[model samples]
Target: MRHGPATRRGRPAVSGRIVLRLDRMMVERGRSLGWLARQVGITDANLSKIKNNHVSAIRFSTLAAICEALDCQPGDVLVYEADDGDDGTGPRP
Candidate 1:
């Protein structure tokens, strides 16, 4: 059997937390993923995941490394975008 897309009903399941824009900052700094990872003593894959926002959790140690390498504050690396209505699903992109 196959399944079809469900009809939009209640609030959309949108995440109130918008993604962090660390990748952009990294680019602006001309830093490569491998370079940052090496500087911070983390694996390249791990850094890539964080850069892509695929990480669900981060430790204070890791956060501190990133902040130190980038010479920026935690707030400078992340942004909080409040969820606008549409339930949680959010407005149509």
Candidate 2:
């Protein structure tokens, strides 16, 4: 359970968190948003939510589709960012 922001990464007392790197990968692949959405079988708007980091969850199937379309591994798309409270270690993107 979350007591407050202390256990969260919203504002103050930030901590490690998962991040999505779909935007950069898409750019490098020269793929358009609409094209990717079509390839992944998701709506452009929904994919936009994921791109902007507004969504909370994504299906493994969707992730696989994205990876296949981009020819990248999951690590190349998702990232883990650790705040100062962590062991001062951060996961590479």
Candidate 3:
């Protein structure tokens, strides 16, 4: 089976990364894990796993549910940080 975001050496991919900002969104929305879980119809434990980036994949349905519950778009909760091929400094685009 295929995996996600892992390189041949089993390290996270260097080119790019997907970040879950669920915890930050929850905090900004003043919502508890348990509460959001209830709203999203998922278990708190599962949500926690996603929040902590322990899981490599998430279903589209789940993502939609979370987006709906948070009253925000996907971009508000997910972020992409380009690695810039090892150079870290750059002016804002």
Candidate 3 per-residue lDDT over residues 31-80, each given as its tens digit: 99999999999998999999998888888899999999999998888876
TM-score, model 2 to reference: 0.74
> For model 1, how does the per-residue alpha-carbon lDDT over 1-93 read when each residue is reduced to its tens digit?
325444376434545574567887788888988889998999999888888889887788988889899888877677656665333234556
Per-candidate TM equals 0.69, 0.74, 0.73
Candidate 2 scores a C-alpha RMSD against the true structure in Å of 5.9
Model 1 segments more than 4 A misplaced: 1-15, 85-93
Which pairs of residues have clashing backbones in candidate 1?
11-87, 12-88, 12-89, 13-89, 14-88, 14-89
In candidate 3, which residue pairs get closer than 3 Å at backbone N, Cα or C atoms, i.e. clash? none
lDDT of each: 0.76, 0.86, 0.84
Model 1 RMSD to the real structure? Answer: 8.7
TM-score of candidate 1 versus the correct structure, residues matched by position? 0.69
Weakest ten-residue segment in model 3 by summed lDDT: 84-93
